[model samples]
Target: MENKIKILLLEDDDNDALLIENILTTSDLNVEIIRAKNKESYLELLDKLDFNIVISDYTVPHFEGIKALVELKKRNKNIPFIFCSGTINEEKAIQCLQLGAMDYVLKDKIEKLIPAVKRAIKLVTETLEKEKLEKELIQFKRAVENVHEVIFYTNPDGIILYANKAFEDIYGWKIEEVINKTTPRILKSGLYDKNFYSEFWNNIKSKDHFVIEMINRTKKGDLIEIKNMISSIYDANNKLIGFISIQSNISERKKKERELQRAKEAAEEMNKIKSYFLSNINHELRTPLISILGFSEELMNEITEPELKEYAKYIHEAGQRLNQTLNNILSLVELEKKRIEIKYESINLTELLKDLINQYSKEAEKKGLKFITKFESHKISIHSDYEITKKVLSIILDNSIKFTNEGGILLSVRTEKINSFTHPVINIVDTGIGIQSEKIEHIFEPFRQVSEGLTRTYEGLGIGLTIAKQLLDLIGVEIKIQSQLNKGTMITLIFPTVAKEEEIKSEVEKRKITIVEEPYEKKSTNPEILLVEDNPGNRMLFKKYLSEYFIVDEAIDGLEAIAKAELKSYDLILMDIHLGSGIDGVEAFKRIKSFPKYKNTPVIAITAYGMTDDREKFIDAGFTDYLKKPIMRTELIETIYKYTYKNN
Candidate 1:
């Protein structure tokens, strides 16, 4: 059976409608007709039914084929429209055809109606398919134009064939201007040589894909960096057809990379300068500090009067505070360099916290603020570095006491679970002046402060929290801060529990040092010693501290020390690292060790270059031990006694 074709007849006469139906039926095709005698009936039938074709009698009494055609055109209907009229003239027929009638047929010659109907139906099917394809093409164009990257197609010879709208936006070129007239080389910035393009083309031709960064110039004479990916289009037979390239702009990323490299270099230079300045400043300050501390302690030891001894004790304490500040600066530098070593030990958190509280309680009381402590138990133990943990706890407590003026501070310790393991949590809560919300994030950055200017209230180098955070990080601890403006602040420290017994044993073993003693002693009344120092004040201070225990000889520089050591047999040498004009302490010690007599004698490094690497450097240069400046009298005396007496 033939497929049925639906037809709508807009004819006023019954005779013409019947004649058209008979003609279609006799043409060996299945046809169905729906008749509309007026404009109203025609529109109603058009809306109610789907028709493959419309055949209307032109120039009817009240309605005409042209009016029907106009209605169809207004509704955007694409059905085939034909004119079939009995009394229409040539001019009228031409007008009907021009008004979008697919074909014209006369009623007197109704035999021609079948052929015209068949032709119009065939044309309608092709027209529908073509319209669908055009719509799809428009959609594809829109998709390509809306993409962000530049896309273009070129022939095998590299001449441009098609360019998307994004290419116009990126390269500042009109699509019409570039087609068949430009090649990829037209956008080159000459940043790469011919060899680069040669290898790139060769690789893509063989591998069918090439991706790289390209520097190109726009039509407006601006340079841009782009990440370009080019793929070779191929046919089923593996023959190269053309090329498609997609380019994303990377100029901003490249610019940032260059800026970062420059910034890194500048930071490195600044660090070097800072290291030199700190070394010099510490040396200069510690020379006088040692004198102040040593003389005060000596005065306190010899004085009988209580008030005078009290005055001397205060002087010694003040000097110690200055020395602690210098040590903090040096420790921070070492921490930043990742050179600080952590010596782990099993520590009782209760005892450590209690001792720290007692130490700072007096300072808090002096400021009229009470210090409270809440320890969970008396036997809370954790594996950690004792000295570093102590320093970190002190930093947090100091900050709490320093900021809180009106309300008291509370210190608490307990055991808590963090992740998969149990950890010791220490919290310090202060009812003092709190940190601002915006400044909390920046508090752990070096030298950052909430208030600035000459009249600001707080006093600190702003390195306390930074040091605390870094030291805690070394021992696998976490710190968190919570604060509100004009209210209070709380800092929490979580220390990870050490699980292995081997670590604790190894730490203890590594810290053990054995001193050998001679069996028979040829003891001298006073052992001979050499004091090598560039600064006169430091030299005098060292001599005075050691004068009662040893026969001291002084050298102004490394060369003078070497000259004195060669002539005399000295028992010990205190060599300063930074000599003014000649060799430093390391070099002088190496020269002194060349002689067999002084090689066995102890030469200790006494300078302010006390970084992590400085000790190793001094030991490698033949020094027996290393000591930092602003030395305490007791420490100096003990070290001297150990070496001088043990050897004899």
Candidate 2:
């Protein structure tokens, strides 16, 4: 089998054309030869057919080898061309070669045609392959230049070597200007110090790749942030050659992050200011309220006329409602701040609910509403914060009594097994003005009220249910409400139960106790009490209420209280927290406790800042007990008797 070769021969002699074909045939190449004796035939062969090689005589009738070569060049074809002439000069041969001729073979040396033709064909094939590769390289360069991200190449010394068009577009710098220039330092915005760059370079050199966010300045001196991903380019022998980097602009993203941080900081500062203002406002309000409530109760107890006593009762009730409103505001603040802490203890749910029912039942009767209780189990126990749970129940029961005008309220309790646990669920059903279905979803939101007009009958700050829901959620309890407008509302509270443990004896003793009437007696020991307060009215009012039962000693501020405390040992010390123009009560208590005689002297914190965490704060400050301001006469006496009489 012979390899095929197509040839276009421009020669006037037919014998010479036949001789050229015979040489190629003997060289194991199948020759497909087309003869063109003149310019007309040569042009026709070139236009009509594809030939691998062209052979022409140096001198024909009018057309020659140079003309043929010039014609092939006009067509812009890459086919190999050679001249076969018997009378060609050396200069003419060099001229033909210079004009893109592959080779020239004399007619006398026609045997050399075979080798010369093979060389020319081999050279053309290599040239075509090289041209194809050059086209692909051009396409690849175009793609890199059109990309959006800034791309650059740098030497191992961090000197810039090459940059794409995107680099110029983004940084406003031509490639000629940046070549051989060191990066980062030229573009540094001075946002970072030398230590930052030192560490960054060390990391990249060790890791061989690095991505970072940095602030830089453009040629226009505008500050911009960029996220740069850099990778080290290495040779096949694992030697570091250079680095390539792709950078994306992130100035807008960084600006947004800074704005959000500023906003967060502003909000935090505002919250601090609000909390401080509320604390001061609470103290100012409670101080006057204590005087009003204390004096009113004293008048109610000692007044002889019926009408005057009723007036005193009204004043006390009004003060009580105002104090409750203040407390609700503080509680909502604490809940929002997430400062309400739950102290879990083993609780007797049955006893706690019964006590709450008894307390609210009298209020229900006063409002001409019947209060009923149903218990499916007598001994229901759960682990929860006893005080918080009691407050939650009181809030629900008070709302029921306040909203109900005609019908009654029913309280029910039961135990059911739910999801591998026995849960104690309490239900409060009221036949009051029920909530609308659409409004039920938002009922638990703070300060939300169903009736919102000046002439509205409901009297509340509308935070009872909000506080109840928050407190219930804190203790891992679930609540459900079902209501119908103008008919009734039922609320269910489900408490997670704990396994039976040893009953808390202290909790049993803390149950509601009725004050027993003392028989008239003349000879008795009078309990000594220390009243530490800054407000003169609060001191006078507290003395008037307490002086009837005990001998009271007064101190105007924490410094005076400390002086008096060291002088004598009292049965109990009532310390007001915010002592004006002197050391605070907490500091005075700490000083008094340093004395050997007053170490165990039971100091109770009587403070106006009665938020949810107030008691915990006092307890942590080494107080034996805590009480909120605008204190009732009964509660005050009971707290004293518990610490004094019970211990004795």
Candidate 3:
């Protein structure tokens, strides 16, 4: 292997051995020769020395070159052996060559010795390099076969040259059957059109690295989705020799993706249907409920008989309950759909709880239960959505009053420093029929209620807490509840940020400033009102109510309302949305507002479209104010008086 060759020679004649060394030294092979004359020294030296070439005399006194060549063959060394004999028969020379001697040079014509030695060195070097390369190739094959991904290589002609073990296992084919015997078309499933195949071939040839998702079939004809990557393998001369492909099975993943897509489409369809149903149901139910509640309140006021008045009161109360339930359902939908907007404001937590406590106190007293409160500080406030905060507390306190028949409800507030920030925490402790420990965790789940004793007296839609929790989470507030069986429940409302005292005072002063009493002057004894309603019964109700305070003019639809408004200037207008097959209230209002005289006149939105978004939509459409239907007498009159009086 080294450039400096070492040769061992078995020669009795030192003169001849010196001659061979001188001839090799003249060449550039860098020769080193050591002489062994006899049989024992010669054979022992052949076994011990790691020389490149062995040269020997054919017939020494005790040594024969034929015997040494036979020994070299037995040792299985690939070293080259040569003979320079004084007397060698034709049969003996042939036998020596057959026994694996590389070449022989006759002593008479000794010029052939250097050429024979040169030939021997070149052959051995080529053989060694070939053997080393074969070992490395085998190791590379083993590594590729052990990976999970399918790996294969093909020649430039698109003929499969080699494939790893994973390729055979995944494709259900033996490696011998595919290698050098098949092309990529053998696995094509024909699921794609001709254009797909054309694209596939073009991309691989044009790009150095190409990846595509393909549906290919196994040997057994089972389709499989795979993501395949092909990269060109180039040789040292910068010529493309072959392509290497790696494939990952994605059949199961693709199946799941298809299923999810279908489910999404189905859900979208259901949402559209639900919106249609909600729209219809809102108008259908609230339209009649408006008449029921309105007429019942009217009857309760005018009826003289005690029994008749009590019946009217029952009708109004039941209508109110239905209206509240409907509101909760729509509110829960808004919260679930993430359509509710959260606007944070500084609110006086003390005054908020006091207002809620005052509102619910009468209900609790009517149930023969005491309502109590303890404010740790009268000045604690929080930066949160005021309406959402009020609604969450209202739900908890209302639930408390409903569940507790005879037990008192205690509402308290205290301030604490959590994580270096002041948080105002409101705790509502009620001695009601408490919930089980296992049920406390699921109290915020929609439409989920736990009745350990299966109490049938409590009534609710069961989504109040769910809505409360979602609204609080949107505003970054936290709530916690602790309860025991029949012992009562303690709920903690943790506000995220505590507002400064200056903010509370500023809000209080703003409210106080708006309460200034001003001298009132009536525009006329009877202010005119244009009542626009499509429903005949609703039209009569509105006209009857407003007729007492204004010279009421009636219009059955938006067209009529616009026509009447053009003919007469009124103090205020009650416009109902969804007026039959004609235009809606918003379009009619826009038309009237186009006139300079009616642009500033108050046109209130009174509609049965009671979804959470509908109220604000009307307000944003430039209505003076919005009032949901199923309207009560007090609410309708008060809203009307606010716009009509405009004084104090």
User: Which has the greatest TM-score?
Assistant: 1
Encode model 3's per-residue lDDT on 1-648: one tens digit a residue: 676777888888989887877888887676788888888887788778777788888988865778888887777558899999877888988998888998888988788888898887887777778878998888988889899899989988778998889998899989899988655788989788889887788778887776667799999999999989899999999899989999989899778767866786797688767756765676688889889889999999999999999999999999998887777877765654546776767788887777788899989999999998888988887777889888988999989988887789999899876533467889998888889898899999876876523675567768889988877766656788999878899999877644344543343344334433553234555567788887898888777656644677777766567666665678889998756433457667887788788988999998753446766777889999888765654457667877876642
Q: Give the alpha carbon lDDT tens digit for every residue of 1-648 in model 2.
A: 134568889989879888987887778556678889999999988988887789999988878779888988878568889999888899999999999998999999999888888886786667768898999999978998999989999988889999999888888989899999998767888889999989878767875656667888888888888988888899999999998998989888778767866786797799878777877787899999999999999999999999999999999999999999889878777776667777878888788877788889999999899999998878888778998999889999889888899889999989876533457889999999999999999999877887867876688888899999888766667789999988989999988645222221221122212111333232335678889997899988888877856788887766567666655668789999766333457767887798898877788999764457788878998999999876765468778867866533
- Check candidate 3 and list the clashing pairs: none
Q: Give the best candidate by lDDT.
A: 2
Q: Pick out the ten consecutive residues of candidate 2 with the lowest summed lDDT.
A: 507-516
Total clashes in model 3, counting residue pairs 3 or more apart in sequence or in different chains: 0
CA lDDT, candidate 3, residue 187? 93
lDDT per residue for candidate 1 within 507-581, as digits (tens), equals 223322211132324346567888989788898888887885588878876667766666667888988876643
lDDT of each: 0.79, 0.81, 0.79
TM-score on alpha carbons, each prediction: 0.58, 0.54, 0.55
Question: lDDT score, residue 626, model 2?
Answer: 98
- Backbone clash count for every predicted candidate, in the order shown: 1, 0, 0
Better candidate by TM-score, 1 or 2: 1
Error of 2 at 580 (Å): 45
lDDT of 1: 0.79
